[model samples]
Target: MTRSTWRTRIGFILAAVGSAVGIGNIWRFPWLTAENGGAAFLTVYLLLVVGVGVPGLIGEFVIGRRSNRNPVGAFDELAGRWFRPLGAVALLASTVILSFYSVVGGWILRYTAASTTGAYFTAPQEYFAAIDYGLGAVGFHVLFLAMTVAIVYLGVERGIEVSTTVMVPGIVLLFGALAVWASTLPGAGGGYDFYLSLDVAYLRENLFSVLPAAAGQALFTLSVGAGTMLTYSSYLGEDRSLAADGTLIAVLNTAIGVLAGLVIFPLLFSLGVSPGQGGPGALFVSLAGAFAELPYSRLVGVVFFGVVLLAALSSAISILEVLVAYLVDEHGLSRERATLGTGGLFLVTGSIAALSPAVFALLADTLANVVLTAGLLGFLLFDGWVLGRLAREEYARGAGPIARLFELPWYYAIAVVLPVFLAFTLVTGVGGILGIGISTRGAAAVAVLGVGGAILALRRHGVPG
Candidate 1:
């Protein structure tokens, strides 16, 4: 059987961008920005996106396009069965993320519908608290998962590429309009100042604390660590420059994130709602409350939450596709069967999350970051030591002269610098999750040791550094 591939380069790019631009940008980015030093956090985040995220993205693209297979099979085909476990980590990462992500998608779906009826306008916090976790949440999660499965079942070109082609542009247009309207809101200047103005002293004081959060968000927002990008790139039927495509995707994803902050902060400040308040409920509670106070509250709410729904669906589709692709490529399941089976699995897992607050928080806040970081760490190691020069060959296959010039630097960044950085973040992430305080020196030692062990293992596998 001939495998499905993207119909056009633009289709591939837009679909990839759709995966990248999601709740992470619309919901999490503003909250993280607010919790950190606003613009100071944004500055560091942009640097990391450029420095760490893009190179990591290209690495996934290389692995995917080179193998032209799903994550698990990509490893089996490229290296050997021993490395298949690395791919399984990615598969696990995708499963872990989507299991909880569907629940959040359900929340966005409910809000989108509720917005039209002004259901939550009267008391947004109370409304969210009521429906956040229960049978009601499970119903919405199933609805959202069904929508995602429908698309994935339709296959790649007919479903994902086509839908994102429309959805991505709609997201940009809606967000642009919302940002413009947010600018006109009374006292919006304060929001802009809060988001854009850097606090050098705050950054200096809390740089260590903020770094881990920002790094995790960078990985999450790019959709890099969970094999979504790898799965998406595996559909690429052409040899267009992975470097160029990766950079463009990163830039567009960052722009959408910044634009989300523009819309969210201004609205929050207009209502005098602190962005940091409500924690995970910040969007559903604070922002929903802000929408309630607007002149055309219902309409504003509908448009805002509708945009979120689209973003959520786009991302959910990508994650679901990871599992679906695994089944189809590795097990020879039909697309329909694979998607339905995957949906059934999430139906159970997502309902579990929707029903239990503790489980949802554990998956979303803690395990998601740790698993994604570890998954990306495995990918970079494979690309660096196992694939070695072949990774560069795939990277430079269709790259232009300008992109080709940075091949060596890009390789080194992904091979040496990123693994070390990811190791540090992984340690910090685990420590933060377990409430075990790790000193800077301790974390650094762990990172170095982890990287050394990976290198030694690869060498023993007869892979040249």
Candidate 2:
């Protein structure tokens, strides 16, 4: 059988953009920006996205294209069986993320349907609570999972590439229009001030407190850690610039996120809604209330929620594709069969998350962060150490002069700097998740140094890539 590959370079980029521009962009980015000093957080977040996120994204791309295999097979093929456990970390991240992610996708689907008939406009908070965890949520989760499964079952080039080609452009166009509409609302200037106004004092004083969250959000927005990028890149059949592609994905994702803030914050302020008080349900509740009072309430609600639905479905499709690719490559399962098996697994797991808020929080918030950080850490280490010299060779394969210029430096950063940075973030993030208070800076330093020492020793022993 012929191996599958992306039909065009644009297809791959769009699919990745679709993956990156999901719930994180639409929901979490705005919330984090508001809570962390608005424009100050955005500045730090953009810095991290470039300095760390893009390099890590390139590392995943190199691993995927070099091996042309799923994470487990890629690691085993490139590094040896002993290093395959690192790939397992990625697989684990994908599973944990999609379990709860599908649940949220279901919520978006529910909200989209509700907006058509103004179901939630009466009491948005109560509606969210009622549907947040129950059999109803489980049913919707299954529906969302079904949508994801159907897309993955269509084969890579036909299903994923084609769908994302349409979905990504639609997402950008719709959000752009929403941002313009939102800007015309009464008192929208206050929202702009809050969102774009940088408070240097807040950033200077709260740097440590804000860095980990920013780092985590940077990774999340780019869809780097859970093998989704790796899996997506594995389908490449041509030599395109990985660095160039990674940069574009990061830029577009960040732009849409900022645009989302433009739409969300302004609309909320226009409606006299306090964004900081909305919590996780802010998008649904406050926005729902705003829509209820607006002149073209029903039309606005439909368009707004429809954009989120597209965003959610596109991202869920990418996450589900990772496991399906694994089964197809590693287990020799047919694409349809593999998709069914993966979907079946998620049906049970997602239903659990849908029915139990505690389980959803555990997977989505605590475990997902730790696993994604670990997964990216492992991939970068392999890129820097195991693949070492060869990693650069692969990176330079389809490159222009500009991409070729940074080849060696990219190597060092991915190999040395990023692993250490991610190691620290992983430690602090896990500590936060587990409700433990440790000296975060000290522990992170010790942990990164320990790993660095081990890498140095391994190189001394003459390990081959």
Candidate 3:
């Protein structure tokens, strides 16, 4: 049987942008920005996005298009079966992401409906706590999962491409309109100050502490290290300059995330709400409370949460697609069958997250970050050390001269420097999770020494650089 392929370059790019632009952009980016000193964190994040994230994205595109296989099969085909576990790690990241992601999507969907009905407006905090776990959460999760599975069942081009092409543009338009409207609100200037103002003192004092978050957010915002990019690129029918596509996706995703910040921060400040105060539930609790007090509360609530629902559903489609593609491409299951099977798996796993706040926190905060960092690290090492010269050739296949000029440096960065940087991030993230109390400098030193020793061992083992 023939494999599935994306119908057009624009379609593929739109789908990738849809995957990248998600709840992370809307909820997490602004929170991180507010917590880490706004413009200062944004500056470091943009640098990392360019320096680390884009190259990592293109690396996945190269591997996927080169092998034309799902993550596991791609590694099995390109690097032999011995490296398939690396691909499995990518698959694991996707599953871990979507399990909690779908539960969050369910929450967004509930908020979207509640906005019109004024269900949560009476007592937003209590309402959120009441519905955050147990049977209600599970039922809502199943509803969200059903919508996701239905789309994936329609196959790649018909379902994913078509849906994102519409959804991505809608996300931009709605959020853009919201930002414009938000700027006109009374006391909105304070929100913009909180969002865009530079805090050199805060940044200088906490640069090292913030670096880990900035790096992780760069990866999370771009949807790297999760196999979603690889699976999307595997459907490509032609070389359309992986470098160009990766850059466009990064820029669009970043723009949307920033725009979301514009909408979120101004509204919060206008209503005197503190950003990032409530953890992952911050968006639901704080924003819902904001909507409750505003004039035209119903309209604002519906539009805001509705846009969020669209963003959540679009991202859920991509994450779920990763495992579905694995089943179809590697196991020869029909698309419908594969989607159903994956949905069933998530039916149980996602319910666990929806039913337990602790499990949801574990998956979303600790497990998701560690797995995504580890997955991207594997892909970069494979591109730099394993694919090496061939990876560059793949990158250059349809790239213009301007794009091709960065090929050599891109290869070296991905091969050596990025792996070390990502290793330090992985270490710091694990330390944060385990309460290990390792200093950022200590983590950096350990990561560099570890990479150097690994390079020497690989050289002695006759592995190609």
Candidate 4:
């Protein structure tokens, strides 16, 4: 079977942006920002996105476009069987993310439909509590998974590229309109102050506490740590600047995320609702109540959730495509068989997540961040050590002079600095999740030791640097 490639450059960009601009941005970003000192969190997150996220993104892109293979095959072919497990880690990260991600997608789907009839307007909190877990959640998850499978079944160009080309623009345009309208709401200025006004003293005092959450959100929002970007880039047939494309995707995703905050914060503030109240349920519970009280309640609710649905679907498609591409490339399955098989697997996993709140929280809140961070750590290590100069060569390919200037610095950052930072974040993330106390020095020691051991192991395996 012949491999599929993106039909156009813009198609590729839109699809990549679609993958990045998803539930992570629309739902989770605001919730996280609110929970982690608002503007203080945003400040750390933006710095990390530029410093760590972009280089990490290009690492995946270089591996993907250079090999033109799924994550597994790319590693297997590029490095050796020794590195195949690294790729498998990325594949697992994708499966883990979309399992819970589909459940959230299902929620968005349900909310979008219910918004049409003002179903949740009467009692938003109670409605969410009732439907958050159970057979209804499972059914909706299946429905959302089915929609994703249909698109992947249609092949890359006709389905993902075409759909995201429309969806990305729609998300941006609709979000722009919502933001504009949100600015007009009375007391909306408070929302702007809370979100946009940085508290330097708070950040200085709480930088360590804020780093893990900000780093995780940065990875999550950029779609970097998972193989989603790698899988998407594997469909590229052209020689273009990976740095430029990766930067653009990150910028677009960040812009949309900030725009979502613009829409969400003001609406929450205007309604006298605290943004940080419900944790993961904040977006639905808080926003649903706000929509109900607003003029044209049903219309507002539908549009908001509908945009969320589109974002969710776009991201779910990229994640599902990772598995589909793996099956087709590595197992020699047809696209249709690969997609259906992947969908079947997710149906079981997503249903489990939906039916069990503990399972959902485990996947969404804890495991997703840890796995994505670890997965990107592996990619950067492989890029810096195993791929070495080949990685640099691939990065510089088709890059413009401006992009070329940063190639050496980018290489060192991905190879050394970013890996150390990711390892530290990963340690902090795991310790936080498991209720363990890890001092910053302890975490740094662990990160250095971990990276050093990996390097020695690669050298022992006769891997070239």
- Superior candidate under lDDT, 2 versus 4: 4
Clashes of 1: 0
Which regions of candidate 4 are displaced past 4 Å? none
| Predicted structure 2: lDDT | 0.84
Clashes of 2: 0
Residue 204 C-alpha lDDT in model 2:
93
Candidate 1 accuracy as lDDT: 0.88
Clashes of each: 0, 0, 0, 0
* Per-residue error (Å), model 2, residue 222: 0.8
Q: Can you write out model 2's per-residue Cα lDDT over 37-126, one digit (the tens) per residue?
A: 777788889898889999999999999998998989998888667777878888898899899989988888898888889998888778
RMSD (Cα, Å) for all candidates, in order, is: 1.6, 2.0, 2.1, 1.4
Query: Candidate 4, residues 1-465: lDDT per residue as tens digits?
Result: 778888999999999999998889998898888888889999999999999999999999999988889999998888778778888998889999999999999999999999989999888778999999999999999999999999989989899999998888889998899899889989899889989999999898888678988888888888887888998888776578999999999999999999989988897788777877767777887678778778898998888888789899999999999988899999999999999999999999999999999999888877888888999999998899888999999999899999999999999999899999999999888889888989889999999999999877876763576
Worst 10 residues of 4 by lDDT: 456-465
Residue pairs in steric clash, candidate 1?
none
Model 2 segments more than 4 A misplaced = 454-465
Write model 1 residue lDDT over 382-426, tens digit each, in one string. 999888999998998989999999999999988899999999989
Summarize candidate 3's per-residue lDDT along 1-465 as a digit string, tens digits: 688889988899989998999887887777678777778888888899989999999999988998999899998888677678878998899999898888888888889888887888877767888888788899889999999999999988889889888888888998888788788878789878877787889888887668877887888888899899999998886659999999999999999988987877787776666765556666777678767777889888888888788788788899898898889888999989999999999999999999899999888767887898889988988887777788888999989888999999899989899999999988887887778988868999989887777555434532353
